[model samples]
Target chain A: MGIALILVSTLAAGVPLRLDLVLPDHARRGKAVPITLRLSNPGPEPATVYLQGRPTAFDIVITRADGTPVWRRLDRAVISSILQVRVLPPGQAIEFTERWSQQDDRGQAVPVGEYRVTGVLPTDPPSELRTQTVRLRILP
Target chain B: MRTPTPVQALAAGTLILAAACSDGNEPTAPSNETPSAAMQGANQGAPDDPIALARGVPGFGGFYLDAAGKPVVYLKSAAHRARAEQALTPFLRSQGLAPSQLRVLPGRYDWTQLEDWFSRASAGVLAIPGAVFVDANEASNRVTIGVQQGSFARIRGIVERLGIPPEAIEFQETMPVRLLATLRGRVRPVVGGLQINFPGFLCTLGFNAVRNGQRSFITNSHCTNHQGGVESTPYYQPSQNIAPARVATEVSDPVYSQSKTGCPPGYRCRFSDASRAAYTSATTSTLGRIAKTAGPNNGSITISGNFNVTAEGSASVGQVVGKVGRTTGWTAGKVTNTCVNVAVSGTNLGQLCQTLVSARSGAGDSGAPVFKGSSNVTLVGILWGGIVNPNGSSTTFVYSPMANIERELGALTTF
Candidate 1:
């Protein structure tokens, strides 16, 4: 009976959250590339997700084909000091689009090559939810 | 192993050679070749060069260096790309370079298309509630329209019916726009963040300005006049006594002048929510720096007499900007939109194009100076109002660019 009750409690806790990274297959060297981070809750019960950063709630990292880190979205200084939390509803998906100027952390143009772009969502309790690696090719 | 013969060693060395040898008598590559055929054709009889060729091309949008540090030309469309390539290929060959040296990329829209959209939108063809702004995004090669959530579908349909391609139009969600002003009373000195006291209202001064040789300070037009009218009310700075001390008289508040006609061709009507107050003292009286805090606040940092007025410049989307005001002392924000048309509620002011910054600005923060950089501040605009969300959180702060303000008021920021 205890095991069955635990199963029921777990079912009532709602489904696990999922995050997807959306990026273009190819982009120009100096052009701005739009990257979308989509968060979806597929369970019946709604879950509250908190965004804990100023200006933007998530972070992005772009690395070369050999896994050498190139650029990071969080490296840019935040102008607004206010931090915000956004709530996510059940069965609904929310996406935020951020643009990358194809430059590295030092504000120089990134070399033309295949790169791996990763999106990470920082949650409470010092946990991080990472998305699947998305491949991007920088064309000259 | 057996020793290799001299001939065999020579053959191996020939295969492993790192550099090739050429006879000194061989003809050398031309260092100064005549201009390409495409360049000559594009420039006609004038100076034939890449820049001149780019300018003379019919559908050329612009040129920028690519990742390989080669010049690339942006053409209006695929058809234009084809024509441009055909004209330049022969010239590239004459210069001992391949057609690929001069890259041609397809542009979503040319300069003409963007200007046409701007002119039509400013002329009220696409004017509607919820659609608060229209601006050209050069980086994305599209025209972005900011609209309220309720009016998104309607605005999208209207834009589509007007022949704007679906891919070339972007819509952003925004709150209903309103003017930043309230009924209050106070005044003080400390140019940018000081209070301006009118008859029954108070506002923050934007910046100390100079028109011709006269010294003055600028503030929101709505501060001097609630309704669409002008008033020559005496201005005062906040004082320890009950009544503030008179510092200047309102010389011009032109926000509500109906006698003026439409702006001349190629220029949109200057819908400025700014006014200039002639200083009662000498030009050296007011400091040129913005206050670190409001005058009413005890920790206000006054501008030094030696401070210089930085040059005024335009704000780009994604650029960081800072502001000092009465309510929200010193705060920094990012420019979200450069050209935004806002409709102020409860006022006869129909719509005005403003520069939108993401910051926390309240009712009393209107007319504050929005500047860029910390040590060397460059004046960008004047705080007019902001969109306060239902929960009282501000989505964005709206201000008029200094370029428009200077043209409208015939004044510039004084050092």
Candidate 2:
């Protein structure tokens, strides 16, 4: 009876939060392609979402289909890396979006292939962390 | 490995030689850029006194000396007291109005007649009537009259007696002329009783202007016949006229074909395209002589670029236009009014699609392509004259509409 109560309480307090990774599915070679992230806050109260970046987290990595990484270190990116956004008020839902491009970093040619991207989000305790992943294809 | 033979080296070189030699000898010039070759001699150091040059260039179009020695350009002639008196004498006497109420305005009339009347009035004339509205066709073969400021009823009665269509009359009391003494040189005669042969005339065999299956090569009526041999306006001597000319490859001249010395400081001489071709097929041609000759006689010939004789595109107010002329080169302008009745001088009469005032054209700007943009500058109108004044400062030109020109030219023959 105690185990059932605990399970019921956990289900009642749990939040149904969903994060969707948005990006261009395909892009021509040698073009500055954009990648977007969709942060959906599905709750009655507003939620503050933070994108955490390292003190020197100015690097972008493009990987080949075989999982070998092709990365470029950026000297100075144009826009702020961390996007702090507020959710919509009340039951109204809102989408938070941010875009980055290959032109932001100096890199080698992105050969035609399918690849995956990942970003890490940090929470207050430092121990609790959230991660996001996206899949995209580069066109010739 | 054995050393390669000389023949083997030659065979390797053949691969490099195998590539196509397609790039032409010359490249295209920038659209708005004047050539550098002519620039060296075009700009002379400024004169000590700019007014000296103005005085040197003989005042031609709408110019006169003012009291301060500075030349004032008037877009219209100063009121001609005598001409006004002549035009108003009948009206004033008939109206039984006193001389004080009916003032004789001095110096103000169309440039066509103003030049003659102004010279005559300057010699001796107490005061000529202003805006007597004479049916004067002078200078650039323009139909101009004067205006009178009085009671609206009196002005109406005078205007009625002048017999000018209400639309043709402008009530602007003041006409503008060139502010400086500028020389308008000799007005190039459109037809010097000579012929022009386009050895490289581009042919649009009347295909574009016809109904289903009808064929004619688009060509100019002026192109139909001209003077003999090289003694012609364009000085081109063609062996014969081909019914249909094939498309010739485009050609541009980088070097001046013939150097002309002593061109005025601001002017430069450039070579004109003298290309030609022959057509083997027929199509409905839309090009024709839109107006009579530039002279008093209606015998002037027209030069044409290849155009499809398709139906004229829609006419609109405030649209852009372009034209290719035999003398004035290529120019562009805009449409001002439509179906305007202009008193065309000489034997030709009636209204034309009136073009707005564009300075890009002049007397010989006749028969040039007057169309919007790159589309076949469908021959739209004939440029007769501009809003001219006696003092020669600001003259805005007007053109006959293209529809009227096309209707008058009859069938559009395309090559």
Specify the highest-TM-score model's number. Answer: 1
Q: What are the C-alpha RMSDs, in order, of all predicted structures?
A: 30.9, 34.9
Candidate 2 reaches a DockQ of 0.00
Candidate 1 Cα outliers beyond 4 Å, as residue runs: A1-140, B1-189, B226-229, B239-243, B255-270, B282-284, B293-308
Recovered native contacts, candidate 2: 0.00
Two-chain complex of model 1, DockQ on C-alpha atoms against the true structure = 0.01
Provide per-model DockQ scores. 0.01, 0.00
Q: Which stretches in model 2 have alpha-carbon errors above 4 Å?
A: A1-140, B1-311, B345-357, B375-398, B411-415
Scored by Cα lDDT, where does model 2 land? 0.31
Q: What proportion of the real contacts between chains A and B does each prediction keep?
A: 0.00, 0.00
Ten residues in a row with the worst lDDT in model 1 chain B? Answer: B1-10
Residue A51 in candidate 1, Cα distance off native in Å: 33
lDDT of 2 by residue, B83-157 (tens): 222222333444453222322111223344433543432232213344333322222112223333332234434
